[model samples]
Target: MSSSSPSLARAPHHDGSVTYLGPVPTRPGGSVRLRVHVPAPGASRVRVRWGQDGEPRLRDLTPTPAFDGQWWTGELPLVNARTSYRFLIEGPDGARHRWLTAEGVSEREVSDRSDFVLDASDAAPDWVADQVAYQIFPDRFARSAAAADRELPDWAVPQAWDEPVVAAGGPVARQLYGGDLDGIAEHLDHLVDLGVTTLYLTPVFEGRSNHRYDAVSFDRVDPVLGGDDAYRRLIDAAHARGLRVLGDLTTNHTGSGHEWFRAAAADPTGVEAGFYLFDDQGYHCWLGHPSLPTLDYRGRELRERMYGRADSVVARWVDAGLDGWRIDVANMTGRQGGVDLTREVARGVREAMTRVNADTWLLAEHFFDASADLVGDGWHGVMDYAGASMPLWWWLAAPGARPHATVPLPIDPLPARDVVATMREVHARYPWAAVTASTVHLDSHDTARFRTLAGGGEHGGVDDGSSDSGLARARHLLGAGLQLTLPGVPALFAGDELGLTATTGEHARTPIPWDARETWDAATLDAYRELVALRREHPALRRGGLRWLSAGVDHLTFVREHPAGRVLVHAVRPRPDGAAPRDGEVRLPAAVLGGDAADAVTLRGEGLVRLDDGDEPVLALPGSVGAHLWLLPGDDLAWT
Candidate 1:
């Protein structure tokens, strides 16, 4: 008497209509109701059935004179959890369809997948709030000295760090720096020193190329980057150092070399035929990319194999002590209007992870306009690019250079305000429960380096360029400050602390030059380190409600306050000649200030001030630089 195997019962019907009901609950004799929605209204008879797996029972449900074309409800006796049932819809001319017994089951169609159900009790771990994530692109980070000792595999070629990656095309320009997990493990101390509490490794699953986005196997780690044992040891070491590890999970597509794709491509009618969408026009590729083939969740066996059944591939990884999953291309999972396959996958992943660790998080990578599908009941969080990085570029680079306007591009300062407004609006529309905890980042392996985007080497300023490195660093710091102070979890790309600039693709994913003191801008690094320390010290900066105080042509100010007595004020000055008054002031509703006429504040600007008597303490800005202020009641010299 399992839940999946339920008893079936049939009932008498007239006007060519019949309704079949469940294998009643086996626990007890509680009352249950059967509800149905009829689209077309007509003179019809309804039949209801209920029973256990072995024994079947039948009953007739007569249509009342006041019957409408909408919903119909009936009460019946319930048993226990060991019951499964379905409804048989009978239309005119012997047309029939079967419907499963579930709360949110779809009547129009029946699929092998189920929707995700979320509970507040199933919230992600509390420690996740304090985590500072650093994403690593394994192939470009660092090369392992141990790789030379190991036997070379057939699928991969041993390339030196200086060698360019070889593909079918002549001499691929993007160089392979040979960065691996062992390399990352060797440099854990560097990350720890930079205040990183979580490390998100790009797909380490066995694959052919440097970027492992096109996964070939979900069960084994890539041998070239040190296989399963290497990953296990890396996770162990990371955990020992108080760092959480999240592995990237690619579900939307697989490599052309994957077993399922190969099998399906060889034979159209094979067992793996439904695993991917394939026809004469090559395999069904995403965005016309032949190397990566999209997965099809329509097949019952495929769904069960990939995401439906417990102890599946996804569950097995969670059981292996992996902290969480970062889903790739989440928006394309269930595009066809059947049952949302993405939700189903999320549910299965969550259920399996919950079995191992209830607080496990599920983060999705959705490119654009995925708020509706991702927020309500789909994923725990998403890779937040729109709310952070996009706004940052718009604010920093869009002001001076119109990269998208003319032939050479003209910088438009008008869009800068719109970008900030949009970010604030998006955050407001999708509050903390939906959007706040999202991972906010500036640059990753996919995009150009932040410095390069800010105008690289055109004029002489910072790093022999007219881009003004100091101003760029200030804007970058301002962006980081905004991200850390906002509701979402702030993520920093490696080497961003030292103001690393990129000239090309390889430069964007290059290793952190820890030994290159000459390349590092000490002042910029200090600013970032101070910001990180400030965020770590203040609980309000990590998880708080953001209230926009004011926004102008050259100045932006905001306040972040938590439920506790912590409050932080952030103000940015974008123009050198613009002397905008810092009119916005944060005042607590409750009087935390005593009768002491003097007030002491720690401001980010030069010099210290002690106010004797005033309604509000004012700090003057030094030139065009930005400032952060912390107000305390009494005289305390301890500055964070």
Candidate 2:
């Protein structure tokens, strides 16, 4: 069948009032209860087909209607802690000849692969779903007014507070403007005002460079960034203001200046010799980079010192008031030339962290598919760039004035269908638990700033859309509105709301404009504030299952439904040159939004958005370059 196949039949969809989405675990070895609504009145037979995790064979079971006679319930004997199932509603009053499954009533048979999965063990920290995180680059976020940061390492090139870190520089990563933890603590009020409850600081450990992927030690914070005492004070202050701080760790390799590596290199027969893979040629570094050497997790001593032991790095920081960690280059860690111990290492780290704080969230910096690492055993989730952010950026953000704008990944704008299909395909591969816990980000320290590319910060050409500040802000706001309605912790990079400009990754790491913030656009900041508050106000927006209503070439309309309620988000690009704007009305299926009659939904928005929840609900939108949101009452909690 086509990807654009009609999800529902022309006749009234046989949507039962009963929900198929919820917690499915019923304890070990206990039967899993499942139900589906037989919305078609007088429907008699409803059969359930299910299979164990990834199993091809599905056992069939029959269900009987309850006293209300609207839903059919069944129980499947537990096979494992995780499995999937689908409903086959037959003997309906009318319409489809085949049956109904999780994807809705269909004339064509739907693949059982799309069946709803139940994993009792799939759980992450509850606080993860409710968080709105701010990503901060330690060396560029802020600097103290009194602190003189001019005295820097010989390898680094120091710059003024307001200067941009040009991509074509003498030493890119090593350049430091000296933003410290104490500075972050000083600006706690800024974060609280922006409604950022979670703070993600890129590595702050002792290292040769500013980026700090190359850690020189495991036990101490960098003295350049105010050292151990400064870190402790910063965490305490952040916590006092109700902010959770997350640290960054690199398990893949160690800096050349690290004590372990220097000692191992001096004597091959030393105790730490076995900790790394050393050949006759030289050291076994990460990707042939001599400055960084990969650790061999096969060594019991290395594993114990890094994560497995109670006093190890993972356990120490998590217990020391840190909320969690973001593992750097996690895909390459614990794997070298067929030696794969990624799971073992991650599980060890997770166990160590769990000993201190069970709520500790462990995420990974994976540039590719990481479903294998997120299978309910290791990391809670990843940065999620590959799954959603990168592709969405390619489609939504304007291609800016960067030299090599055409990287391997698609930079050309993709149609709305392609965007929707890509997200769905990536999401289907992961368990829903991992999906919601992942960091849904637009851009980070490793990528070009989104505002520079999309918000018109990089004025490439007149038609580029950055020249018109109002148009650019509105377009950027649409993206923010759509992202806030998505599941996962809404991750916002620092200075993004300030309309910062940067054409490349190095440039994106430019310092926050604390000294000259008065020049920033107030409208853009208000848009961001409102979007963050909107997500905070609704539980459905934070952790809802996406149900796409329509995907046009220039527009995306979807409903996010949680037990609490449904949030309708619709976004459309501006009208093309000499072309008329789209019709200001969109009709959605009544059942998808939890209402069968018009006026069932009560809308609250910043602009015009009218809702009529009839059998086929219609939303009257007013502008081409605008996003309209509406909410309908649901059986779930009013708010989490």
| Least accurate 10 contiguous residues by lDDT in model 2 | 9-18
- Cand. 2 TM to true fold: 0.87
lDDT, residue 172, candidate 1: 37
Expressed as tens digits, the lDDT of each residue in 1-640 for candidate 2 is: 0111134212112211123444545344666555554433435465666675546443444444322234555566556766666656555656455555434455577775455555556367878888999999888888865347435667677777766576656778777788988888899898999988999999889899888888889899988788888899989999999999999999999998888898898988997887788988887888788888999999898998998788999999887889999899898899989899998888888888888998888888887778667654688788887777865775576644231242465356667768876776666556677777788886778777666556565531111223555555655666677667777788888877777656677777878778676766676678778888888987778876666667666667776765677677777765424244343344443444445324344443434333555454443443356667777666631221
What is the TM-score of each predicted model, taking all chains together?
0.71, 0.87
State how far residue 342 of model 1 sits from its true place (Å).
2.8
Report the C-alpha lDDT of model 1 over 492-603, residue by residue, as the tens digit: 7676666665534344555555455576666766766777777777665665434443344444544453433234354454553344433323222112222121343464
**Alpha-carbon RMSD, candidate 2:** 4.6
* The best candidate in terms of TM-score: 2
Which RMSD values do the candidates have, in order? 16.9, 4.6
